[model samples]
Target chain A: MQLRLETKQLNYSIDGFDILKGISINVEDKKMVGIIGPNGSGKTTLLKHIYRALPSEYKKVFIDGRDIENYTHKQSARKLTVVRQENSSDFDFTVEKMVLLGRAPYRRSFESYTKEDMQFADDALNAIGMEAYRYRSFNTLSGGEKQRVLIARSLAQQADIFVLDEPTNHLDVHYQWSIMALIRRLNTTVLGVYHNLNLAAQFCDELYVLCSGHVVASGTPKEVLTPKLMAEVFGVEADIMQLKNGRLQLVINEAMTAQ
Target chain B: MIKNRVATPNGYGDIDKSNISSVKKHRYIASFILLPFLYVLSVFLACAFGSSTVPIEKVILVLKQELFGIVSEIITPSDIYIVWNLRFPRALLALAAGGGLAVAGAAMQSVTKNVMADPYVLGISSGALAFVSIGFMIGGVMLNTKWFLPLMAFGGALFALLMVFAVGGFSNTSSPARLVLSGLAVSITLNAVGQYGIYNAKNISSSNAVVSWMMGSLGGSRWADVWIPILSSLLGTAFFLLNARSFDLMTLGDETAISLGVNTRHLKRLAFIVVAMMCGVSVASCGIIGLVGFMVPHIVRFITGTEHRRVFPLSFLVGGIFLVCMDILARIILAPNELPIGILTALCGGPYFVWLLRKNKGRG
Candidate 1:
């Protein structure tokens, strides 16, 4: 059952400053949508609202054609899981146990984990190539490893929809590609905030470019990533080239000059 | 697959099939059972050892005889008075205070995301002291009722927390560092207020009574006064355990917990109230015992690891035991004079606190 994500006239403000103003977006069934923006562009704020981290106004967000605000926190979590960036912790848990916490939404206040929950957690770890690290202390793992474990946790939630906020903030290049590829392979309805324009353009089926709290441009990567839009919105001068692999490759000359 | 091998910190080397409820849980189960028993033993030992040093067998026989309400004069009434009326109540009070303080500390550490947090870090104890000091200044019927002091202390705790929040300028973006700094500043300010209030009091009592109360004392603890600590600690510990998973998630920070379906704000409010009440009760009964609230959780985690499930229960038991044993030494060391419970806690907590800080020295 594929659900469409729709947002209409979403407005958010803090300290009399508008962070997002009358914003609207829609993600089609099971397609990956990436929201890319420069710093302070309200990309994280938009995603935060969708995931109920902040209070969203009534009827502003709709998932599966029903208002997202209508769902309780637990109900929404069961349908939509979040793979957050920078999940650092002071306390330590085993990797398996961290993944097992993803089952919390399915559990009642008094319920303990059953055999099926363990199986699901194990499978998630296996899917993310983190089964070997199941017994490792969560905080002791390297950044890339921690990110993978967090992804496994979200997967264990068994949600058809996932939202990620700056999903690859501190990852190295290889892990970045691998992590994005892992999400692509999952075939879930994904809404992600990305700082890396190239990665978003590469993996996302649809793209939304947020600039200064507004959707400056949005479409398929090929359609929205024109030279003018790049220069105007991103303050960058770039040559969009179609290489032998038929992938859109952005080559920049004097990229630093735009800033 | 039926789980077989166990995963210890040294890697999975245990081969017993029964030892396989995931390595950490199984090992912790042992400590959980063993530690509470250790606490009971220490309580009994504490009951037996004092200025007079009653025999353990006599103490046990008295306890058993009392359990059945059969007074066959097995132990003399004086010994019985020391063992049952005076010693047991004091020891039980210490256990409850320690257990409650430790659990509150564990919860506070997670809630504040600060390793420096104790049960009273939000100035609950100081707040209680301030209120009690104010009461001392007013004197008369205000201090006459049995429940009056604790209830005042509890109110003071909530007031102190509010002051902390007001001074801290609580916001979603404020780092844990900022919050802790704000709380400490408020605490220092309140401490001054407490001292000033006591110093200027026009009451017809010794000034030492107010000072000793501020420093923390379990002296003259009657069975009548033990329930506040017992009830609040039990509720706080139960709250922490029931929401233990949320506590673990909170260590990961607020945004992730919210996304994972935790009502972070609600849990935080609940934790704050519970910690405040626990600290208030402990302070009212025992006069602001500090070390159990601060170091017991850390010491327990050093051995049991930082998993909340293990940390909470173990800290509760060990904290109780540690304080009781320290109180035993307090009763015996000076001979006819007793040291304040707070002083004993600091004596032990100081070295361990230094070591923990030194171990984490390289990192800011």
Candidate 2:
């Protein structure tokens, strides 16, 4: 699809306070880009805007050079998918049925599901290693399993672009790395928000660091994850090193105490 | 929260280690065998037992004559008419009302993502009450018209439905929390108006009729009352079934729905109108039957799981059967002078509802 995602001069506000101010970025096709920031620094807000969960006030968000507003919801959904961090619902739907909702973009009202839709849903379940738990009720799933199922649902949409907010949040160590590996293996254009600097540096090809709704740094992990940037942006002292394979890594001396 | 946890079924070292797939298959097979038999039995039992308590043979003869127009040697004209025009219509009415109320309840619960949601949640009953009061005030002039009650009730329901949506701020994107709050606010207001009308009426006869109607009795159901509710319920049921997929998606919440390409705002509007129409017709014909809407859906959920495809159809059948049984109880409990069906439903529904609330209190 030669997919590309771009946000130009994006600005957002909630309750008269700016959340994402003058944010601009371009993500090339087939790369995993990580967006990392402190709490309330607008990572989730930016992802929400891209996924159309929150309306953009002043910005241009384009997918493959086409204006986002020009595409209908179905059209956009068919072209892009999203997996959000927050999971809150009071429903009692089974896991398979909930995952099948991922196919909704392709079906019309009163339309019966086709065999291909079932295939896609089955494939998604297989991809996330949730086939064994397909019949479990959603309320019964663990947090990490729920997150993986959410990812599986987005994959079932067959979208070229993915915008995930904290995709690794609530996962154990093994599943966290495995999920990142799967996202990379899919080779879809990905914009992910992360809290773990180590995971972001290990997985993402490029990084965008935001401080107070402004992009403070944007480059490869080696260039942007410097000790100076960490101290300046996050008020933390960190050591940066390059392994023999030539990958950058960060080792934090200590997590800053809460004020 | 963590320390006070109950002994868990799926916890470490629990013996119920059956996989999810096997558990689901077992549940599906059990329900498949159980529900249909129950539905048929409920229908026959509902028809057989009433205040008059006729024998099965007489009931069959009466039913055959009423349905096929065959002149039977055994059954008399009064028995035939009572069975056909009176009891049979009431049974059918019970089925329609039960199924309609249950489907409406399930749809509302899905759309609102609130367990307490039902046809009455959005002032449908208050609207019907107001219309019934208005029909009484207009008296003989309105009474002469055949469709007056249904039309007035539908109009009032539509008004209340619109009022809730308007107050809820149903924009291109609607919020379910706001929709529920708006419904609560409007229902309280309209109910006050209904109370005032009851207080000011000169004759208690008409007011008493309205009160008993609100308590939902099937005793007065005639063939004429049957047609409107039947037609409206069928239409509403068809609408809900057609959009059952959308209702399933709605429970995933608005953000997930948007991701799946559903315009929730439009769906919400349509569901509100259809549920109001069904309940409005029900109230017009049979007063305000409560609890069938709430209990029937939950009972179906216990058996069918939460896939809307199964839940919707199962709820429809289960709801119909539930009301038929409740109606039979109402008729025979006091024999000859039946109690209101609503009273019995409420008596059962209230305790069950409390237990449900308590069970699910912190799970969410």
Candidate 3:
């Protein structure tokens, strides 16, 4: 029973300033959809509305064709998991302990994790190549390591949909590839905010290009990643090329001159 | 250009699970035994060392004599009365105050996600004392009553905290800044009200007693008054222990917690209520002890890690022991003229806090 994520005519405003207006997006079960936008494009805000972090009107967002408001937070969380942008904290806990907290949604308030829960956490860490760092302090990890651990923690939830926002931010190129590969291999329905268009084109089955709080373009990356769309949406004169391996690479020629 | 992945899933590694589990288990066991042992020893030492200075051996005999009704002529009746009536109840009340405040502090830190937050930061003590001032103004010189002032003060504490919540909370959840500002506003207003109530009470002696009470004291700990703090701490501890997992979730911030199926607003609300109730009860019992609520929990987290399960209970024990020792110093420092326990804790905790900030300043 794979869940499909859909939003229709969603509008969000803060203090009379609109953040998102009439944004609609849909991703089929087990597919990956990427949201690519420049700063203040409302990509993260749209993700928040889908995940129930920020409230939206009833029936505006749906999972599995049912209104998202129909599901309780617990039910929605069990179906969807999120990897947020920031996970840094001064407080220290072991990597295993940090991952084990993913079971929080499944356990009762007074309940402790079971052996099976531990096994799931172990597997999640293993999937992220962090099994060796299980006992390591989470706060001491590099940015990439912390992001991987956070993804592992999200994996421990075993939800049907994974929502991520700029998961590769601050990571070196190697970690960025590995983390994206890990998420791709999971084969779950993913709705993510991606800052890198090359990675978005490479991994996402579909793309939604947001500019100025609106979805300016939405379709297959080949259909949407035109030179004109790049100039209009990103204000960058781009040299978008396809490699022998059939992956797209986007290179910025320069910022547009005033003329 | 496509590149080979830097780190692929190794499937499953042979985890040295036993080492981590054993290390964690050992620390937990050590903390459980060590904290209680320290608390009991401190209680005994604190109960025995005073103006008359009952010996440890006599303190044990007095306990045996009084608790089991084993009449022993080897110990003087005056010593028994001092331990049974004066020091034992005082020590217990100190334990209650320290333990409750520490646990509440731990909860508040996680709840607010601010390491600098204290038990009384939300104006619970100020609000409680403000309400009790009504009793003082109306009845001249009634500080020594058994339960009236505490009950009234508890009411005031709840009212003040609720007002803070109302002011700061939006929709469901509250920001730490809003809560702190609301608390500061409410605290100033309540303190003004209390001052006005006390100064206009028409009796000089009553004014003096009210002034001392506002400064906070453990001198009035009677067996009758002990039950409120004891039961309040016990109940509050139970509530906190149940929500210990939620507390840890919340410290990850509201978005993370909410994503994990935790209703962060509800968690914040629960935190405000439980912390306010625990602090309200403790302040009502011992006027207003300051340092333990902020210091003990901070130290406990430094020792035992950030998990609230250990942080809450360990802080309770550590806090109780700390306050008991502080009270002992209060009694022996000036001998007959005892400084208020709050003054001693502030004097001691102030320096420690300064060092903590200096040490952690580099991290900032």
Most lDDT-accurate candidate: 3
For each candidate, what is the lDDT?
0.79, 0.77, 0.80
How high a TM-score does candidate 1 get?
0.93
Docking class of 3: acceptable
Where is the poorest 10-residue window by lDDT in model 2 chain B?
B1-10
* Tens-digit per-residue lDDT, B287-331, candidate 2: 778767878888777765666766777787888888888999998
RMSD of each: 3.0, 5.5, 5.3
- Evaluate model 3: give its TM-score: 0.88
lDDT of 1 by residue, B77-183 (tens): 99888988999989999899989988988888887666766645557678877776676677577677877777777777778878877776245456555665766
Q: For model 2, what is the error of residue B77's alpha carbon versus the real structure, in angstroms, after optimal superposition?
A: 1.7
lDDT of 1: 0.79
lDDT string, candidate 3, B1-364, tens digits: 1111222224423244314434655677888888778888998998799877999988999998888988787888888889989999999999998999889878877766666567565677888878877777775446667567767777787788678667863222454456557777888898888778777766545555556667777886778879989988889888999888888887887788888888777777777777777887787778778767778887777666778888888888988998998889888888886778888777766787678667756543
- Report the error of model 2 at residue A61, Å: 3.5
CAPRI class of candidate 1: acceptable
Q: Would you list the clashing residue pairs of candidate 1?
A: B216-B287
Deviation (Å) of B363 in candidate 2: 3.9
TM-score of each: 0.93, 0.85, 0.88
lDDT of 2 by residue, A143-221 (tens): 7778888888888888878887776777898878888888888988999899988899998889999988999899988
